[model samples]
Target: MNTEQQVETLQSALLARARALADETLARAKHEAERIGAEADTRLRVREESEQASAKQRAERVYRQKVQAAEIKMRAELDQLRWAHVQQVLDALQERLTTLVEDDAVYLPLLKALIARAAQAIEDGDLVAQVNARDYTRLQAHWSTLAAEWVPGKRIVLSPEGEDCSGGALVRNRDNTIRVDNRFEGRLERLADELQRIIVERLFATATPLAMRG
Candidate 1:
């Protein structure tokens, strides 16, 4: 072991240390670069996810608005249709009802049937078969005949003290305790309520109107 040998050994040791340091630095740099790349990728993915969520939310909002608008339009149309139908029914009933009461030829059979039923419910004296004023005079003309089939002169056919009712008739015994209600308007009112319910069920409640779908 001399001075020269010692110097050479020191130089070799320094060189080895430098090489090791260089390798460590390179490895650290590679690790840092990979970490940075991973962070950037994560940021990009997160940003993309946020953008997709925002777009979906916007689409949902637009769709909901369209649905709402459509619903409002449909309701308006349905309301209009119902209003038209109601008007048509009212006008027809108001016009045709007068003609019905005026025609004894048309009403006699119905009156006879009603009178027969009244005959069963009341006692003989002062039993009044009352109807609208329009039909009263026509019905009174044949009292004996009407009563003959009724209670043998026990009752009278009379017109109620009013202009005219839409439909049906009422038979009243003296005490007014006994009465039969057969009114046209009254019957029509019941039918109208039923019709309203049916209409609602047939429209928005159903898949669609067959005629419209066709």
Candidate 2:
């Protein structure tokens, strides 16, 4: 009950209270630190997974784009090559055609064949052959023999007309009603496309691809 005894009791109680509060504060701080560490670890793992997925997606997109671009470029190059090859082939074919037409033997046979074809078309009567002044004399020398072979069952009289012609002869009756064209160059010029086509087919039979000439 004395003042000294009361003072000692109060001091001991205050010391015990301080020790208990310090222990509680330390435990609470440790618990908070553990929670914070777990949260940080979780956030790090999530970020790493997301970044990996994004990187994989980007890589796949780049690969697909590259592959597609390469395919398109390849097709373009192939088309260019194909067109170039076709143009070269056509140029060579034209040169070959010009050479064949300029040859003597080839031109002669072609002229003879055209003449015979026109002569065979003559009607079943007497025929008067009309030609330009240039070719009139030439036909006169060979008229009899040519008619004999050209028109087997008909008679032909060779006559030179005043009309201007490039080459070849025109056969007409006395009345000049029905006529046949047998000109030297005229007949060939008319049939130029067909003749060229045939010649090309024969000469370039072993070529890479057949020509489609118009």
- Alpha-carbon lDDT of model 1: 0.69
Off by over 4 Å in 1: 1-26, 114-127, 150-160, 172-179, 194-214
TM per candidate: 0.63, 0.39
Residue-level lDDT tens digits of model 1 in 1-214:
8999999999999999999999999999999999999999999899899888889888887887777777777778878886676666666766786677667777677767766666566665677666766566665677677677655656565655642565456677777788766566655675777766665565547445323210
Q: What TM-score does structure 2 among the candidates reach?
A: 0.39
Candidates in order have lDDT scores of 0.69, 0.65
lDDT of 2 at 32: 82
Which clashing pairs does model 1 show? 167-183, 167-184, 167-185, 168-182, 168-183, 168-184, 169-182
Enumerate clash totals for all models, in the order shown: 7, 3
Query: For candidate 2, lDDT tens digit of each residue in 124-177?
Result: 477776666654665578778867776667777777564365454676777777
The residue-level lDDT of candidate 1 at 93 comes to: 62
